[model samples]
Target: MAGVFMISDHHFGHKSIIDFESRPFADADEMTETMIDRWNAVVGKDDKVFHLGDFSFLNREKTTAIVSRLNGYKTLILGNHDRGRSRAWWLETGFQEVSEYPIVYGGFFFLSHEPMYMNKHMPYVNIHGHIHGQKYEGNHYFNVCVEHWDYTPVAFEEIVRRVVPSEEQ
Candidate 1:
């Protein structure tokens, strides 16, 4: 069966991101290729992939090329870096959907490119990206950036695993 997955901050074709993120790649090309490989290795063509944000730094052609090589039905939520391109442009480059703001998923998870403020009073878990390695210290927050998930997509089942155990404990 197809699965659902989430990931963020790929920074594809951005050479500086390698040094900035301490990525294992020697350069942007290596990072991009390796990430594509990793994505395809796990995601099936029919899988649903929510790429939280900051998907790439390349031009339309390059971005489309990378997206074509990957496996999954992809959706993009804009991040700060992704805002430079119009939503239509992202669609042209192969993302099935692009949202300019946060969206609620599973009725309780708030999905966005940046972390949302949540307190105990709130009834939602915010699943977000863009902070790279900074995690909010509460069960109400989850970071899906590549840095936190071995530079690959975090499965929906895995997200449930984390949330379920926390609630049970």
Candidate 2:
């Protein structure tokens, strides 16, 4: 079986990635191409990729076209800035939206986006996006990278290190 993978917050076609996020690319087109190249490098034809959110900065047509070219069966968790059009388009392009997927996979809980507040929560870490590396720091919760420029999968162990207490580790 092919390996499973997850990534998010690519924000393709968004020129702000370079300016706002200080990404390496110079423009949205360049950034989009770079991300695609990186994703294809590690993802196989059969891999399962859970895209946390903000897949594109463009409209549904352009975003869906890009998604079609990428390898793997993709799933999306709607981000705060997501346009409903994109989600509707994704349904036709072999992508599903994870409203509240509750299943154990590889010994972890897979959440699309992290909730703001919770009284009781699952023992497993919530793999999510909206918050990148720096944003995750100091917070008790954990979030995985959606824009995996290298298509690298972050393990639950790494997240646990930050979110879980030392005593638990």
Candidate 3:
């Protein structure tokens, strides 16, 4: 089986993210197509992908359609923006979202959309995306949108070794 992966804040139909994020694509369609292509390139049919939040800017139908075209089964940790969309809407898109979760996989904590405030959960690194790669700092954090326009699902091990330091590891 392929390795598990996680990504977030792909604002797929938002043109402003290109400038705001210094994205490589010119527009939302180009961004979406490229993201899908890139995802398919690395992700296999059996690979599970966690999309933390902000999946799209368009309506639920458009968002769902785009998600359906992508590879892997997506588990969504819904963002504040997703609250407007009904639960049925998200379910139809084949993604699961929750307010707070404590799922342990890949030797890391998967808390989507927002990092925890307490340090008591030391070994449990919180993976989240809602700040859009700006003005945020904490322990064991990484942004997928930093060096690329397309989404790159980073493995927790990379984040731990690179950003968190060996002492923390």
Q: Each model's TM-score, in the order given?
A: 0.95, 0.74, 0.79
lDDT per residue as tens, model 3, 1-169: 5657777788778899899878889788888888888878777888777777777778868887888887776777676667677666777876754433435556666556765454745665666677765634566555544233246676545656655657856
lDDT of each: 0.90, 0.63, 0.68
- Candidate 1 steric clashes: 0
Rank candidates, TM-score, best first. 1, 3, 2
Best lDDT among the predictions, by candidate number: 1
User: Model 2, 36-73: lDDT tens per residue?
Assistant: 87778777788777776666778667877787778877
For model 1, what is the alpha-carbon lDDT of residue 114?
90
lDDT of 1: 0.90
Question: Which of candidates 1 and 3 is the stronger one according to lDDT?
Answer: 1
Clashes of each: 0, 3, 0
Segments of candidate 1 deviating more than 4 angstroms: 166-169
Clashing residue pairs in candidate 2 are 7-146, 8-146, 8-147
Cα RMSD (angstroms) for every candidate in the order listed: 1.6, 3.9, 3.1
Model 3's lDDT to the true fold?
0.68
Better of 2 and 3 by TM-score: 3
